[model samples]
Target: MALYGLGMAKGLLLTFSYLFRKPFTTQYPEKRLTMSPRFRGNTFVWYEERCTGCASCAKACPLGIIRIVTHPRPRADVGNDYNVDVFDIDTGRCMFCALCVEACPYDALHMGGEFERASYRREDLVITLDQLRALPKKPQTQFRPHLETAGYKGDTELDEHDAGRWSL
Candidate 1:
């Protein structure tokens, strides 16, 4: 019927109107898209020196993906009470909630801005203490307002001293 054809023509016109417009999707790999300030990315940046071995990050994780091992310090009263021996984060099952990052009282843990970590094996996704030590400390400003105030836009990697507002 002519009425049916009219509806079809309207749909075709709408499609054509948008066909020449700029696409909303970014050309990935060729051009990296900038994430928002509060984006909870998959990558994590941790500074061990600032960590107090309190296991606060592990306790705050809703998925229980973080596992920490600590030993009593020789002189507990001297500085930090415990010496962190192990800090493992199973990113394979992480939800990217950012709860652990916010719960760290010592400002040692932070969510990184990059999300390009793609691995074929599940074991490769498990981040150990050694791997954490090697990872670049490029922290995103999700909850830590101090990092944002310090002009950390999450684009560049920072050293331990500059990562947190209250340095360890």
Candidate 2:
């Protein structure tokens, strides 16, 4: 009987403990919590004009989630160039290891820190070039030089010989 009474008292104390305790939940959307610097959220990258269509990213992806299609530039073009006709990344299968980003010789890809990746359908998770490009550049605190170099710099060509030179 004493043990039963003691258990009841403990339960009641725990219940009362919360009566004056401040609520830990914050109003989401309006009040967001800052993520830590090392947080690995959604994987995103810049489609910098420097992407040589070398297909290094596609090859580096272990899950084969990255798909890229390129077309030949006109022979009159001075430097090697290809039109990126298709670039798709299935976020559903991505492990976010950032191997693709590191494999890029032109430093075209980088990890972005946006964690709200909820989706209702699988197709919605497949990000396209336009969608990835539309993401706002992260603040300086999270900035990486590899990502900043994605801006358009007029017509330029990638040196084919240098594509395979980068170490992953």
- Candidate 1 residue runs with Cα over 4 Å from true position: 1-3, 76-80
- Top-TM-score structure, candidate number: 1
Q: Candidate 1, residues 76-109: lDDT per residue as tens digits?
A: 5686477889999998899888899999997899
- In order, what lDDT does every prediction score? 0.85, 0.66
lDDT score of model 1? 0.85
lDDT top scorer: 1
Over 4 Å off in model 2, which ranges?
A: 72-79, 115-119, 139-168
lDDT of 1 at 127: 86
Per-residue lDDT over 64-165 for candidate 2, one digit per residue giving the tens place of the 0 to 100 score: 999999998865656657878888889888898878877876656655566687898988888888886676444121234422354422123323222222
RMSD of 2: 7.8
Tell how far residue 80 is off in model 1, in angstroms.
5.6
